[model samples]
Target: MVRASAGRIWSVSSNPCQDQIHYAQLNWDEDGQPLSSVFGDVYFSRVNGLEETRHVFLQHNQLAQRWEALPEKVHFVIAETGFGSGLNFLAAWELWLTTAPRSAQLHFVSVEKFPLDKNDLIRALALWPELEFLSQQLIDAYPCIVGEGFHRLSFMDGRIKLTLIINDAARGFSKLLTTTDPLYSQYSAKVDAWFLDGFAPSKNPQMWSEDLFSCIHQLSNAGTSAATFSAAAIVKKGLKFAGFAIEKVTGFGRKREMLKAIMPNNSQDYFYPQPAYKSASTFPSSWSINTNLDIYPDKHALIIGAGLAGCSSARALAERGWKVTLLERNNAIASEASGNPQGVLYAKLSYKEEAQAEFNLTSLQFAQSFYSSHWANIGKKTGVLQLAHCDSEQVLQTQLQEKFAAADELVQFVSCTKASEIAGVPLSFNAIYFPNAGWINPAKLCEQLVSHPLINVVTGIAAFNIQRTEHGWCINNDRELQAPVVIIANARDAQHFEQTQHLPIKSIRGQVTYLPATIASKEIKTVICSEGYIAPASAGIHCTGATFNLKEESKELRVEDHQTNLENLREPLQELLAEWENSDKHSLDGRVAFRCTLPDYLPAVGPVADEPAMLHSFASLRKNARAFIQDTGKYLPGLYLNIGHGSRGLAYTPLCAEILAAHINNEPQPIARDLVNALNPARFLIRDLIKNKR
Candidate 1:
């Protein structure tokens, strides 16, 4: 057992709240079925696991019928207590592909305390050759289940999403709850169905606790259905105590009985014999959902800006069956900050598990998987090395390594020699190696993202004015384009809109120096970052530098900026710098662009709040910052923003896009509720109100 102060590494038993991840310990039966060594139970029925899943969960839940009846552009969400061998999820995915509407999406959220290792998953899933196609996809995109929290994986071209939570059932479900605070009123998670499949109650009784049932109840709504293979009294009682109407059904195979349940449309009909947990205070008005808004009645979205944010948002929505009009002010997509030849997929993580660090880690992991899925076309997985050039950075890296020791596959603290070997170039200092991080051509990625059939791209068209009409918003351009939903992803120009003008987003000029790769410089195989970064040569030219300047706007490349880049790289890549120094200084080439950033370094995402209205609504905060104002935040209905990614846009955009899309569709969020609040667009306004600055 290896333990650290913050979390444990490879410990058989550990606390989920501490971000420890323990893989399932399994023993193979005679039939090659996986038996959980910890729970003393089989993962599935050995006789016929596929058929059992189809009968116990799929058929019992009426998924095929429900999916068939789903309206166009709508989505169905299924939450599960245990992810086991992923048999149930794969079976559901297979059925959904053949039965669900093409325009509808399927979101499957599952919690697994002990996720299988990649090899174990591959072997277990191989038992059924019929599910090979779907199984291969899952295998290819399986996240490195090394820590707690949600690992969101997109499948079937975004039509199916898996939010795999590696934690205890009760704790995982609690995270899905709208608000964990007793002071904030809770909201149901719009979970259409639940699959209560795990080890038996006798073998794993802790998972069938009342806390788990309460969370299930909180995340469900009237008419939400559930199916389980357990008919134990504890299971029945817990479900009933949490207001589910259950019936004992014939079990699968040797089992004599199973359970199927649903929440009735009327609360009076609920079987809540005892008092269920209730919030003492009203839900925060700022985060409330206004039913009258009806922003998503039509699944059409107009995205302003054709950069990484806009293109990513368009693709995410398009994959969910929404038609998007992508408007670009420049001659082409990615012609602004995203036009660089190669953008390093770098993550500046903190030693502590604060919001910024957590967000960066999650986004970095997501971006790595996202780009890996697109491989050679988008970028190379050449990996990245962040040199600890200074003593402070070395100490920070040491702390970070200790904090994430279990996640060795994601990051590693290496000696100077190891770093040099990994980079295929001589290095003078120790570094943090990101094995999955690399470089991406933002332009190529943006083009591919917007190439979806549902996305309509318009170039050289700027949306200067936006007006909210009776039905939706209208963008003033060559021709007025209207959409029920609009996303502002135009970088620094995001604040130019009347609704988002109050946003404290600023433009910082950055220039990337282009150096012709020599034989010596070409030896550098991975991205190396200190004050700036240099990627492995792409097309015979190494992209580096990226000098940061504040309040300066010059599209032309500056020689001084090029010199600044070289000087920054002098210490870290001294050997390579010597080789490149002989080149003509005046002929050096580079590109200049401006990045949009916020004071907090977090991007502005989610719905655009009506500034004045929110200030007035939460006016009591001015007098007492902690005052509980029970009012929903006033927002410009259907307007959202996905900007302020700063220099880390490549690492931030993918997950942020998924977050915005989830908000629009009312799906289970891909991240924690607290992280959602951290990225909330109204955060600045709330801070100002608290400080009495308004």
Candidate 2:
């Protein structure tokens, strides 16, 4: 595992990163309806589930009316306790499509401990033929692997976003409520409507507890409202105790009564903001630092560098109606590390359940689905076989089996014999076979991302010496370009700017050798990854090697590095290498590139802070680690960052782009709040203060 000593702010887990999802066990009723065996309750009302959903959730929440009244480009958020069958979500989406403005977006966040299997969810959704058009779209994009934490899915050309939290209801909300960053906390807690759609409080009492209701209260604002199918006394007391004015409503189907509630204007109750972890005391959770900052996308944004980070950021912002000017120092986009002929789309996951590992797993899953639908022409879906290079075969296999009990379709532990069969070649070690991992051409992806009409690409201009202005910010190179917002995504070169000079970013030189594919080597069908990787031939040439040399930053390729790459591949593909050598083609040809990396191996994303103001405001943190000073640090109003991706740019860039876009547009975040804190560009600055280093 990649280890770092940042105190308890970042926790490491010895167990694998995967959280086996609890799938719903279903039984078909006589009327061709689905029943949950564990909760002993039907998914929806016995009489007309669709109409019942429209009344209890949509009509009670006033979604159609609220959506119609929203301004253009405004985002409406809806949070729910249960996500059974996804009928409520489809209903909300269909209503929003017809009632809401074209520029407006909908964000739906839901938590459910037991998610249905893909086939079961598809079958259950199929029963509602009226929603066939919407159901098919959801089924096509639904996550195949249902691991825990957050599973984010985007649909309708980035107009609809769904964040599915696969965990307990109360615990998940508690975790979300612990966010300390004011810029992110407001978005995290801003829920407009609540759908209390879990099984009846009688059958599923754990989901409707006082704690859960209190969490809902904490997340709700003065005008927030809720609707539920239960009017049980405990449910009523819980909502009332949590500050919602509750009222009995007409029950659906055979129910005697239902409930509708709203946060009263005179209600005066608030929960104490909890810390994410016991030892995280560097900052108070109640600070509303950036809550007042207006992030409307009315002005233009200037983005530096046209690598994956920059291009994807440009696309995300442009989709939100922001005019974007993408600047690249080189003559073309992706002409550096992202300019590699082909980049692998796999994540180097660890058993350690730290923030880095969690980010990798989520981004890996997101990229696989994203590339297939958006960039299919430039990407391939050939699965990857990651060999066990550090530990014993038995130990690796054991960990894989225990961690991914429900994700057999996503990955499997294969013995050497099975590994060879999958690779279509000879192999020497057991491997973790990733069925969904593959490769993509980064240059093509970069080109496609910046093709929007709202984006203007400026090439061959190296921006330096950026300064905060009265209106926004100014970048001066050969010319001056000013924008309300600026994003630095120029890899390690981002440190050239005075604001980011202290960032812990360094460059590592890497070289990849290309081998002409022989008859035997051409038969290899899958990407084989050991200490180094050997991809199957895409253009009659198999790409392999890639020596990671930190001491050298020279662009020149040395023959020794090529030899090292070949030597690293000898053991895993001895037969293939021997056959190619026998053909008298010993000369090695390749390309060299540099990768930007951080000490902790996580990318620096989110808004940049004014260093001087931060140092003055949080000065007390250096003396006493737990100091609760009144001053929240200052941020550079429009300056942001998206850099330090290391070699996982293909996997990390897409979601980081979406996160940055959401932060800029004041939209609901696609991932959890804790994970966002982990990826914050200013995390190291906070670390330094906590350690009394600055």
Candidate 3:
């Protein structure tokens, strides 16, 4: 196990010097079997890997029988220690489709130190033709595998979701066990099954350590089943130490014995005593608390606001078989910031892997895949080019290029000539090119998201006077509407409600200039960015500009803002600007909207905390900020928030919606615990209390 301190067993560096992912090295034998070059072990049985996986993982965990017995609209979670070639996940998915109810969802979370390259994965899975359909889908949606964090991919119309973590097994699982605030560790979702599939303990002892078993125990509850192909003494001893009841089982092929275990239904029947070090005053002991609020038995939700945040949240919940009531104050949906003609899909990554940089990169990737799969008809995958217009920007671009050297497919530096060739226009400076990045019509995308049968979109009705009721919450508007769950996604207006009044969100006005596409301007094939961005022509017009004004409140277009947009393009696209300025046929027109943002620039997602209750609960921090308080912050039950996306609503909303839905459904989170805490709705309150302002 990797220890950063005396008590902490899983210590991940917040800012590691090297963040590039290292893919698994493999050697193919004459019989077309993959052997791990690092561990000198075969990835699967030489004799039928498919049957081996079905017998060892699926049958042993009783997944097929359990899936058949699952109730409608329920979800089952299965976590794996190592994801070598994704065979186990594919097998589980195949069985789920055949046995599980259509309304049921399957979530698979896997950790891998060294994931297989795309080509290697394809080659390995090709041996089984029966799984070609599902294998192809997995291959197509697979991430670039360049960074060490959670990469969530959805399949089968969001019925099957995968949270792929590219990190060490122990460290990655530890991320799910605890949040940034160690006291909140009890909030993690417990796994229903565990697949301990990796190299043998003799060849790879690190993967079978006590630390990993402890994480497994922490992420499990009564009746959690575990299966593995190893029957070594260390494996048995570790599982027993972690309170699992183990039994020897028949091996798959050439192996003599395997192990199958489950957590006893009663805690008193556990074999080993709880570790003393875990309960020490200096250690984190909140995991012993049972703080999980009951998931609303009825899968129905009411969401306020119909913008990108609201629409995305509705779609996410609807996909999981929930009936959603989407309320919009305006006469139509996407009439505010989401009504933009075009929005760019790209991330501004920093040199280090901090919260802002990491969240942006992760969200951008998820948004690209989401739009491509769901709204491909209205979106364009024409790529984006970020020009290095100044010395500081050039230096930053260079540093980013070096930082992501191993991920050339995600982002790469291109010469001016090469960039021009790619963009189909003349360029003066070098740029960073994101091949998967492009532009999407946010209004159309929102329409597509809310078109689901399970989501009822109600317009022209403003929700106010939200009050807690005996059954759930009620919004007293023109007509009273009540539901067991509620999500506030009205951007800056989210704070208008009494429960969320303490949120410190501000509105900044931004205006986008619409320039009719000229013959010369139509030649621009890709979205180009410097201080401002100009997208390729769509419907004979190019959407550009977006001047950021903090104090402006008027929604009318300003001539000065239009001039500023043109001037902002001078440094990056001087040649194109010169051609456009001389043309009298083009008229300067634009649209103005307000962007809701926070002081830290990160969106507020997940469950909303009760302001008055939290202030009273954590008030002890005012006296001593470092005190180890046992009391967790108080939260308003069944209340959630998905707002403050600012100008990047198109990029941030999809993943934030998934995170919120996961918390609501009581499933595994799609991101790390630290990132989850970063986007917590009560973060500002915690900060104020720490500073003695509350």
Q: For each candidate, what is the lDDT?
A: 0.84, 0.79, 0.83
lDDT, ranked from best to worst: 1, 3, 2
**lDDT (tens digit, per residue) of candidate 3 on 157-185:** 88899999988888888888644333343
Please rank every candidate by TM-score, starting with the best: 3, 1, 2
- What TM-score does candidate 2 get on C-alpha atoms? 0.91
Q: What TM-score, over all chains together, does every model reach? A: 0.93, 0.91, 0.94
Distance from true location, Cα of 152 in model 3, Å: 0.6
| lDDT string, candidate 1, 120-141, tens digits | 8898999999999999999888
Off by over 4 Å in 1: 1-21, 181-188, 268-295, 477-479
- The most accurate candidate by lDDT is 1
Clashes of 1: 4
